[model samples]
Target: MRTAATILDFQHVTKKFGKTIAVNDVTFQVKEGEVYGLLGPNGAGKTTVIKSIVGHLRPSSGSITISSYDLQKEFADAIDFVGAVVEYPMHYEYMSGYQNLKLTANMYPEVTKARIEEVIELVGLQGRIDEPVRKYSLGMRQRLALAQSILNYPQLLILDEPMNGLDPLGMRDLRNLLRSLAANGMSILVSSHILEEMELMCDRIGIMSHGYMIAERNMDEIHHAQTPVYLVRVNDPEEALKLLSEEYGEQLHAKEAVGGRIEVETTLISASQINRILIKAGIEVQEIHEKKQSLEELYLQLTGGAEIE
Candidate 1:
């Protein structure tokens, strides 16, 4: 569970490029020790929100607070406990990974050799921490970037598209790393188009559409929101379907016969409830099982079939 303290707050924040509104009246908070994800299709302003937090693009209106420090008024103080990696993480290709980290360490105060080594090990790059970054694979580079972001032991970590170029194994590694960090008390705000990964990684997710926040939900809420599909074996399939259809109207989908069973899809009624409804209607149900929908299905439904770019 996250502490009530707000690590990051966007209070009615809005951003505009001339007449174009990039972010509109967005307000949310990332609680302490939570991994909050910003999810949307491309051009939905996920990147714009992230950029505003890191102070790259100033919000056109409203305010942003980081650990209670006003971002606009106290820029340095607000960003003191913040670390971020946005878009492509640039590094000196010619420099060894250790040397690159050494250069970056010069910019922040109190970052020591021990901290650098710890972050390197934390990102699983101890074996190749001394290699030239140019020779490293994309996954390895992403790991290195992650190491850099946390080298200062920031209280808040911001990541934009952190899993952009990773393979399956790399994505898994990144997810594990993030979970480990969050457990250690780091609050992370991440933006990504990867719904499945977000579903797996995030504690809570805020969805966006057309630069507007459409919905926000925690992991458990998302899980319970998945419309349940029930497979039922009854004494009479055709009669049960007719009874359910007539009783429930369009709310139930009791169709498609499979052997002696009928697969029913419904959002409002559970398998047990459906079974009870049939039993009360004088239909004997032999078995009932609920099928869970994948995160992709839920995402599409929530976004109204708006494809994630």
Candidate 2:
């Protein structure tokens, strides 16, 4: 099987503001057609990293390359492959969406009227394409911004807080759109406070904390790596807890009696073994199932409960 090429590469990149180190020695890569999510709390340097990629802020040291072109050495060539909607989408409120798109299209030599129509349809803004920007909802405005961003057919797309003001339906629409784009070979780097959405949208995620890339993992691997918390219900919860506690002792990671059920957390013992033990001890084993740790739970555990900004 052929490996995908790296679309975005960050090599020991660091960014500082006077005395404050906003980003420190971060190294990661976004592969072709991959959706890479950037996650962090407020002041964790996620914005700093995004700004550095978009050329809004220059790195203090190290290197960054997009689509194989050096960001600092061949800035024009590097930036040509990038399209971004940083912070929030901006447009003239008085002008129509079509007019705004036309204005943005003027900046790119290859953006044609047919291409504009194609993007309008791609973002599901066909009916509202000619509507005044001020008359459009936040979701509509976001769609327009997305349409503008992809007008030049950029190989890499960057989105910062793209779902900030969007509703459930709008969020789902945007998510599906991004998935479709990635499927068609456009690599995306996105940062968001919405962990649940990020978990659903991204193939892999890189977590930042206090300006450091603390953790990076594939979503599939995260799912597989989760230690299962088995919820086992029994006729006698107290007896089951006592028996397991005495039998396992320190080997039992955690054991709690929740109403009539016993929630057991362990990596050393299997759920079937627990069930067999209870059954053999004359304790009726009712229902038992495993609950895996979610992305939000993992994020909280990793960040020490720091609230996502």
lDDT of each: 0.88, 0.89
Q: Worst lDDT window (10 residues) for model 1?
A: 290-299
What tens-digit string does per-residue lDDT give for candidate 2 at 172-225?
988999999999999999997678889989999998888999999799977676
| Best-matching candidate per lDDT | 2
lDDT of 1 by residue, 1-309 (tens): 534688998999999999889899999999888999999888889999999999999999999999999999999999998989998889999999999999989897799889999988888889998899999987788888889999888899999989987989878988998998899889999999888889999999998877898888789866776567788999999889888888897787778567788888888887788989889988899998875465566567678775764
lDDT of 1 at 156: 94
Best by TM-score: 2
Judged by lDDT against the true structure, how good is candidate 1? 0.88
Show model 1 residue runs off by greater than 4 Å.
1-3, 224-295
